[model samples]
Target: MRRLAVLLLTAFTAALTLTSTAGAHWHPKPTTAAWQWQLQGKIDLAIEADVYEVDGFEVPAKTVSALHRKGRRAICYLDVGSWESYRPDADRFPESVLGRAYAGYPDERWLDIRRIDILAPILRSRFDRCRRKGFDAIEPDNIAGYENKTGFPLTAPDQLRFNRWVAREVHRRGMAVALKNDPEQVGQLVGRFDFAIVEECFAYEECGKFSPFVGAGKAVFVAEYSEPLAAICDQAERLRFSVIHKDYDLFARPWEPCFP
Candidate 1:
């Protein structure tokens, strides 16, 4: 009985140590407010960019290392709401989880985020991949699909539950996560997400919606694809947004920065 008790105590100690080590290695804070979200390819070392937003799946670990060497943080961009058939792990997702095709993007389909039991593991694995690749944070795109015709009857509540879960999972993995353009829930989710990465918020007149995030002392990164620079720059500055004018494709293009 004495020997058994000692063994149990040793096991408990080992478990506690493992948990502490995992916690320490996983949680990385966002280094800066300014960042680039380029998913076109690998890190363009010649571009002299501060942050390289690369495809979470395609980008290799070496590229992340190179960016770190330059004292730059790398953000891994992954599609959490929509399913792209081209990804290597595409086969892992079952057909039932796939709903209608996303409007304008033929290759992508909306995911049934209601099925968290099925989808959470997949997303967690994706986050794990980003963590393994040395990514400091994650930018999960298409998070606002519930606002569009996703074919599934996704309510605001459904979106809220899914978005909150995504944030929690990323945090659990010790990675900072960004809320990507779910303007309606900004007030509620601002505290949950580390930052806000909004696309064309100026054009949509929804920049005001995400003020909560900025008020919470979190960074709001805005990218305007179609809005006139002169018109949006003033509002962007007033809102304290790190705004940039970029093309729709989001490649390494000449961007008009609203802030110095």
Candidate 2:
């Protein structure tokens, strides 16, 4: 009886530790969140923001550590729905899963999200890299490929399945994941993703579609390339979104935040 009691106590302790660790993942709230997104040029750590979203591969682990040292959360950016020819793992992607070139970006091709078996391993390896680099979260870009001209006959359901898998994988790594620019799936994915990172929603007047995240108290980070702050700032403030006016290249400068 004494030995059995000791084993039970050990199991219970292990369960508690696992639960606490899982619950420790960062979930940024809209009220207190401010963010910077710079995927080009040297990362400007001098930017005053609570969060910095930078390229997972280009930015070193030391940069992530530096953000943490400044009491800021770091979000790792990686293309999940598209394949870039420039990436180090470019050869790992099988040709069978490659589709039409991403419009405007000739070097990037849309990935067949339906082929999860082939993609899962590659993405898992990338996610593992992000986790090992000490990033607090992930910004999986190009997630709404179904709505695009991707050669695959991908339906809404296919995108949902793929996006959910992304969130689950990121969560398993004990990091937050963003739902990038999939306004149509916002209702279904808001609960699954920790936050929403969108581009040009104001330009398209589709900003309202992301209200579900804000309504759920999750941060909604918006990056507008052309629209001036005067044109969207009022509505952005009302929606409680963290809006930024950035250059198309997404360099560290030309950084304009609505709340800042």
Candidate 3:
């Protein structure tokens, strides 16, 4: 009986140690990557890239499988900060959590990040769906809603806390997460996210702000909608970012790749 008790205690200790180790390095950040974001259809799969970003819930599992077969990683794009009217789970959000319309998107409303206790579970369900669909990573959009007129008096700290929770939750599911935009917080968050996807950073002259990601050996995938293609391409190559020019819709439109 004494020997059996010792063995059980040893096993319990091992389990705790393993859990702690996983919590420390479970979400190993990506070192290098090239990715394509297409919220439209499967044509993105044919774009000859190392990674493809597809609509989180709308993409079929077969698409992820196909990307895997081709030695590519698949990322699921989810909007965790805004309530889209077209999403199937749109009604799941309570009225209290919904705020003013997202600045340019009339159909979408910013979510009150302060209601994280209530929102986390809903986001978990969405991330679970992404995992079930076999996505290798996640691209959470609208993370900077706090910087906008969200109608909730959101602070930078509020955005940072919510973004950190998002990173933790995604890592808990064994999937990598990328920090979208919110360039102001890049210095504080570059270590938390695996990679980054930025829009018009060059146009805004903020590309240098995100260089820490590449300095840490993680890839920065950028898309510019309005910059002169030639000028942006030059800067993109110089910065070592996987840069492309696409329309605002992010459909299968003409793309100007900066690298090769």
lDDT by residue for model 2 over 81-120, one digit each (tens)?
A: 9999999999999999999999899999999999999999
TM-scores of the candidates in the order shown: 0.88, 0.92, 0.88
Output the better candidate (1/2) by lDDT.
2
Score candidate 3 by TM-score against the native.
Answer: 0.88
Ranking by lDDT: 2, 3, 1
The better candidate by lDDT, 1 or 3, is 3
The count of residue-pair clashes in candidate 1 stands at 1
Off by over 4 Å in 1: 1-34
Q: What are the lDDT figures for the candidates, one per model? A: 0.80, 0.92, 0.83
User: How much does candidate 1 score in TM-score?
Assistant: 0.88
After superposition on all C-alphas, the RMSD of every candidate to the true structure, in Å, is 3.0, 2.8, 3.4
Q: By descending TM-score, how would the candidates be arranged? A: 2, 3, 1
lDDT of candidate model 2 versus the reference: 0.92
